[model samples]
Target: MADVRLFPRLAAVHARRLLANPGISTGVDPDALRSAAEPFVTWAPSGGRRSTNAELDRLRDNIRAVAAACGWPGPAGQVSRASFDAGMGAFLLESGYLPVAEALRDDVWSWIAIALVPDVCLWRFEGAAPERFLGGRRNTLQRLWSRARVFDRGPGEEDRWELLDRLTEDAMVQITERPSIGADPKLAAAIGEAWVRTAAEVGASAMEALTREAVRNLRITNEVLCFGALGDADLAAAVGEHFQRAAAATASQTGQASG
Candidate 1:
C-alpha cells in the first residue's frame, strides 16, 4: 500500500481561480478535484472545453435508455451489473463496437464496479463447474477467484480488474442515497432499514466508529496508491467494507432515533 493516508487533513479541496477561469485541484474532496482535472488528463485528445456539471437527471436518462435497450426493467433503482452480464455480453456481441477481447475486458470491469457498490450476482460462464455456484449464482464475491479471466493480464499490462468487486453492500446504499443522482427516496428508506438491521447484527455506532471506518479505508486506499499497487479496476473496492460498516451504523442510529 502507499504511504498516503485518507484523512480530512491530508485530503483538502483546493480551488484554483488562477487559470483565465477558476478550477479545482488534488486537495480537499480529491474526487471533486479529479472531476476538474479530467481535462488535463485528456488534454491531448481533446479539442474543446468539457461540459458543465452534467447533472443527475441526464445520467439517469442515460441509464434508463441503456437499461431499456437491454430489456431491463423500467425505472432503474439498483440493478445488479453482474447478474445482467449475460444480457450485456449478448448485446455487445450483436453491436460489435470493439474487439471481442477489449469488449470482454470492459464488461468485466464495469460489472465489477456495479457489484462492489451495489449487490450483484454474477452470471455463470458456459460449461463451468456446478459446485462453484451459490444456488445457480456463479462468479459471485465468494467465487470471484474462480473466474481468473477477470484479473489476468500480460506482462507490463497491469491487472486491476479484480478491484471492481467489494465484499459489502455499502457502495450500493451510497448510490441509492445520493440526493443529486436521481436516487429513489423510497428505496433509500428501505435501504436504511436494511442497513440498520445489518449494523445491529454487528453492534456498531454512528459517531466515531462509522466515520473512523471511512477514515481508515481512505488511508488504506492512499497506501495502495502510493505503493503503485493501485489500479483503476480496484480503486473503489478499498472503501467497500468501510462504507458498508459506516452506512449500517449510521442507519442503525437514525432508525433508533426515529423509532
Candidate 2:
C-alpha cells in the first residue's frame, strides 16, 4: 500500500462556514479549494503512494461528471438521489486510491466532504446534521461507500452490482446500520441476495418486517456460529431460510391484526 492524502480534522464551525459560503456559488473550483486547504492537507501518514494534486483533480473531475450525469444542481437529483449515491459510492471505491486502511481514515473522508466536494455535500444534504459533513457514522459518502462495499456482488458476476440498485433504503439499513451484519461483506451480500429473493416471493409489503426479522436472526446466528466458514451458496441458503421464517412470522402477525 502507499500513502494517501489526509485533510485535517476540521471543526463543525468551519465546516458550516464553507458549506454555507454563498460567494462560491453552485459548484466549487477544485484548484482554488485545494490551494485554500493545502496548508492543512498532508500525505505522510496514510497508505498508497503519496497522493498528487493531479490525481486529486482527476478524481474531482470524475465525481463532477458523475454528478452532472445524475442531474446535480437541478431537480433531477431529487428524483434520482439513490442513483447518484450508488454511482458515487461505486466510483469512490473503484477509484484505485482508497485501500482499506486509508479508507477508514475519517480525516481523509472529512477532507473529501469538506473541501473536495463541499458543493455536492451541501446540495445533497441541504442542511442536514453535522455528521453528514464530518467523517463518522452518518457521513454522506463514507456511509454510501460502506454500503456499496458490503452489497457489491464481487468480480465476475454479470450483474454484481445489481443488489446496489435493488434493495430498499430500509432493507439496506437492516444490513448496513448494524455492525454485527455490516462488517462482513460476504455475509452482507448473502443477506442482500436473500432479501431480494424474499421480496420477490413475499412482495414488498412484507419486506420491511422480514428484513428486520432476518437481520435479528443473523445477528444471533453470527454470535454462536462462524459465518466465515460457510461457502457462498451455503451462506446464501442459510440467510434465505431466515428470511423465509421472517416472512412467515410477518404473515401471521398480519393475520392476527386482521382478526
Candidate 3:
C-alpha cells in the first residue's frame, strides 16, 4: 500500500477550499475531522515493536494501552455484545468523514481499508483481542486473525489485501458519498444485517465480510441501477456476469502488458 498521510493533505486542501468557497459544506464536521487526524500525526509509539519471546503478545499490549485510553475494556475475556456495540458506535460517530477524506487525500484505496480496521475492531472485538496476545492465540483474535492472513509475506508496510486493491475509482467515489448525512438509514442497516449474517456463517469477521459485501453490492447496484433488486436472483446473476467479464478483461490487459 502507498504511504498516504491522507488527513494532512486533505486538511490543507479543504482548508483552502473552504476559505474560497464558504458555502460549500464538506459534509464533514470540521472539529471531528481534526480530532481524528491528531493520532496520525502525534501518536507514534516510542521504542516500537521489540524482539520478545512473543511478538504478538507485545503488539497486544500496545493495543490494550490504546484501547484503555479510549475507555475500552482491557481484556478480551471481558467483552460483551452491548459493550462492543457502544464502542463501535462511539468510534463511528467520532470517525466523521476522516476515512473518506483520507482515502481522497491518498488517492489510493488502501487508506480507507487502514482507517476502517481499528474502528471495525471496536465492534468486532469489543476490546478483547489485545488479551489474546497473552495466550499465544493472537491468530484467533478477530482483527488480527483476519488481517494476518492478508499478509502472506510482506515488506512490512506493503499491503497484501487484494480486496482493498480492487476498490475501483467509481466504487470509492460512491462509497465516500455522505452516507451519514443523507443516505437512508434503513439501507445502511440492511446492508449491515446482510453483511453480518453472510459473514458470520462463513467465519468472517464483520469487517471483512462487510467490506467485501459492500463492494460487491455497490458494483452490482450501480450497474443494474437497482440496489432494490439485490434479492432478485435473476438480476444478481446478470450483475455477477458483468463483474466476471470486467475481471477477465482486467486480467487479460495485465497479462498482455506483462507479456
Candidate with the greatest TM-score versus the true structure? 2
Tens digit of per-residue lDDT, candidate 2, span 195-251:
888888888777987788889988998999878789988887888888888889999
lDDT of 2: 0.74
C-alpha positional error of residue 107 in candidate 2 after TM-score superposition, expressed in Å: 1.0
For candidate 3, the TM-score is 0.25
Model 1 C-alpha lDDT per residue in residues 1-259, reported as the tens digit of each score: 3222110110011112111122211112323433443343211123223322343224234433444564444322334444333233333233333233322332232222221211111122222222222111232322232222222222354422222232123433243324421133232222333334444555534433464455444445444454124343343343345557666666787789899
For model 2, what is the alpha-carbon lDDT of residue 3?
52
Q: For model 1, give the 10-residue run with minimal summed lDDT.
A: 5-14
Error of 3 at 72 (Å): 9.1
Candidate 2: worst 10 consecutive residues by lDDT?
A: 1-10
The CA lDDT of each predicted structure is 0.32, 0.74, 0.34
lDDT of 3 by residue, 135-217 (tens): 12121122222222221223344433322233322332233233431143333333333333343443343234334444554
